[model samples]
Target: METKQTDIKLKTPIRCIVKLGGAAITCKNEFEKINEANLITVSSQLREAMMFGSSSGSVLEMDWSKRPGMAESLVKVDDYKEQLVLDFSSFVVIHGAGSFGHFQASTSGVHRGGLNQPLVKAGFVATRISVTSLNLEIVRALAREGIPSVAMSPFSCGWSTRERNIASADVSAVVEALDSGFVPVLHGDAVLDEALGCTILSGDVIISHLAAHLKPQFVVFLTDVFGVYDRPPAEPNAVLLREIAVREDGSWSVVNPTLEDSDKQVEISVASHDTTGGMVTKISEAAMIAKHGIDVYIVKAATEHSLTALSGKLRDKIPDDWLGTVIRHVS
Candidate 1:
């Protein structure tokens, strides 16, 4: 769903919101297949960043050499007390359906709703089964890292939409969870709808809503691509946009390339099988968050650049060596 997930009080004040792109964790082309390596890499990097900040180090001695972003660098913090104290408190993590549910949802036309139809109804169930399965895996990975993470499924949490746009949501659980110092992990899932019987909710939409109310210090999107581009990165002429400024009027400007998008649209590509809009949706949701003066970073997964971004160490600026995009209000 797309809008009003209205309600979350500032407890510790979220340091940032992280949205895990499904494509980055799963092989989208294969049905229900998780890119185990990428998922491990992302999970390890997240744990490392949250615990160690920018300077790399691991809490585990044996797994230090096997960890993801720590993939090649065999980091071993002999003692847990020696690690740097990083501010990774009060943050939320949201992951997209990716290969887990997208195929089932798309095949069943579940996003458009109409559970009255047998196929739609069946698909809805299948979609939930698949997505929830992925959600559990993510939570388990975080748990292994001892993150104090808790799963908060949106559909079961009173998330409903009207025409695929979030009409209202009850996120008190998320608030309580954060207040309790537990990292509430949320995922995009099928939700009840007003206009339609039920619809698909994307992580992008959820993060946008959270950023609007929580006013987090920053938001990070870990995706398969390096960052937002003038066009699909796969295209020969596509150019990576290092920085973009979303204006109050919904328009945006490209800081590095010196371009303007008056129509609130970019020549981005959406995967044909995606139940929810793809990169375009991510950009749109990101723009929504940026308009509120919250900076959003989009970077590739399983890379050192992503490691740096996830570390949340460099808050004020994106270094010249970074391969990512920063979206914010220029003024």
Candidate 2:
């Protein structure tokens, strides 16, 4: 039965929503060191993926600082904004504050409790400034790539929500951008009051929300690790599940639990301490979205062919046995 289910296929080529994890974008060993080489590889693949779509990009990033590095970079470039708009010709982008506001706000404990605290006002201001700076860098990078990207904040788009509202808005923004012939980019950032309160929003959650809204046929989650492991790779006998089904009911049961329960059962783990949410959170989020009929692939950002594999065109380039965890929709 599991084999039959895994073998099922979709009748059409659905749109895609790719979520690039911060861990994938930034290095886990060193947060400050941007993985330029890895990013270039991912960007190259993303460019390839864009060819398949009418328009592709990201949601605007929230402002993190009163003065942002990206903003400054943009200012350094003559007609940076106009040049960017002319590059891709049409694209939408969303960015998260990354360390800009999160590091400071989290440390200050301003919005420590949630979005409703009076202290949140300070946190909000700090995050806005930080996000602004982050956006400037992103805009500059995209310009260099000739990707033609734009940055927008949740505050400006009226996407403020208690918790997941920002994510919903991000998805809406992506759809709008695509409709308008632009790609949308989005990132994890701080949101005002909600259950999680002052905690950082997970990029995985952002991607999941987008999948739910756009029903992108394929969802790719790029992280630092190679892929979902049955056990931490450091442990003996740890194996990769390769593929799993996410039942519409939101369950991640294995096909043959007893076959490798001791070595092949997928375990939830965190890639780093800075990551507020870990593997479990990502899996749960992706599983929920899969229930809505989207297929998700979680792969390591460092893998040279990661994006290509997700695009269904890198099979020949990768080892014949190479495979990543596949989360499917099982009703």
Candidate 3:
């Protein structure tokens, strides 16, 4: 006589949110095109991070001759896909639109507020199509890797104010998907606004809201550069900031505050098409989440294994050498 298998229940797994920056996943200079090779590598990193639970996992090695973008670097990716004994409990993936939606958003001024003119409204529709295409591509890539990833649109259940900030959102579907063991993949999108006709909702802002609600153990922002820098990484003397710590009152320490006013904000670059606030906005948002007592990591994803490092697979992974930055709150 066999016992009923239905009686068994699984406990909730630890949850995490990972955002793949548009520039990291796609060539921001290119129009509506994804960096297929880079996408493959990043997606594989995500899978490997979830599959292996320890430092013994394989490392991704770089092969520069394969592609000009990832050239001149070797990376370590965990090679034990078959031998991994652990599994990721839960994951929420949010990705920026890069050239896809940014092109339309900036032209239409959607990020500023809403669609007032007919031309701007047309651009809104165009932006939606572009981002949706990219989102699907990401979902399909994860699916092929055997991760049950589901594409979710903020446009369907998200809301914003006339000032172009997220007001309220019905993320029940997202929560439901995660509870059901599906990796919900969300992308920055142009959504309906209460006062403004419509506005562009950025992925960084979306992740913050999700972090508040879901209270994930960690949040990872995978960007093009090596985390937060004292100055733009291109500058001759720019330095990478390893961590940003939050104070008891929720204030954050500005990294190498170089501005005249002593503002902690660091200067960051945005592609011409980008309507979102770019690097500065990303750091601000991550800091906000950190204030809520959640740990956030900003790292370079295109040419590094920062994802695995954040996943805590390697016990001795150095933030500076790994090109990763940590954001946290402390009393």
Candidate 4:
């Protein structure tokens, strides 16, 4: 008998995990409203950032000609041919529901965690529909920018704890998507919980889970504001924090500590319609993820070239002091 040898293939590494904050990309206070301009602008910037990595000789291109429903799709053949020749970075994008699911979750009381009431049960179904709708819109925007993005839902691939936090997630599909040259677009969604009947899994929480498993080089959060502040921007004496350092011992401190102090909860307000905890939760989740030894950035999506800067492509374009908050572990 002859022995046969099997060859193993190396997987492509995902360079970044970009989280599009709900407040940054959509009108969070409005009901199911999406900021098309912001969405389009961010999508375009991401395209530039991904293409910048191509200069490093890693030419990962998307063959748009192979997209399904080619005839019905708005993309032109020539444009498709043009995009196929461009290089793209390996990344996974996760977006928040903003006004879409937030309003529904707030109304249904789904964010309170667990399910026993009939209204909460009904809200679970509605929340999924609302968030998935936004996911489709985001996927379309990225596709329009010549990025091949596939919409994925946390509900379909994740499970939550009794406290409604994500306990475990099957991100194999996301890894496969990245290896196959497609950006997996995921969003905050209503997932079934082992302890709770159901709950809303925020995008930030999803990013934490992804960071633990995918271990991307960078985790970027595109928010409405520039970055974390010493106090809420609405406060009279608030100041921006360019860097937040977390020690290996689990202690954290701001780079430029401010004298003006304020309430932490007051500083991190959830939208009136938002069910998910807002900035406060974001900071906590980011801190948890940072413990995993990954760099986290929170920047404004509306800022010029913000995405490119966060992608490490526009370091020369911006000052040594980046216009965003960076979370990193201290040496």
Per-residue CA lDDT of candidate 4, range 1-331, in tens?
1112112121876778899999888887778899988998898778777764443433233333445656743434464454345556788899998888887888898877557898998898899999999998888788767688899887776555456755667676777787788889999988877766777888988898778777778788999988888767778876877767777765577764443432233255556776678897788888877888888888889576376555675322435656787888776
For candidate 2, the per-residue lDDT at 283 reads 80
Model 1 scores worst on lDDT over the 10 consecutive residues at: 57-66
Better of 1 and 3 by lDDT: 1
Tens digits of per-residue lDDT, candidate 2, 3-91, equal: 11222222332356666665566554553445567666666566555554533453222222335445542223333444333323222
> How high is the lDDT of residue 119 in model 1?
97
Weakest ten-residue segment in model 2 by summed lDDT:
1-10
Q: How many backbone clashes does candidate 2 have?
A: 45
Model 1 Cα lDDT, one tens digit per residue, 128-197 = 9999999988887776665767889998888888988888776777888888878889999999889889
Give Cα-based local distance difference scores for all models. 0.82, 0.55, 0.74, 0.75
Between candidates 1 and 3, the one scoring higher on TM-score is 1
Positional deviation of residue 100's Cα in model 4 after best superposition, in angstroms = 0.9
Measured by lDDT, the strongest candidate is 1
Question: TM-score order of candidates, best first?
Answer: 1, 4, 3, 2
Residue-level lDDT for 316 in candidate 2: 28
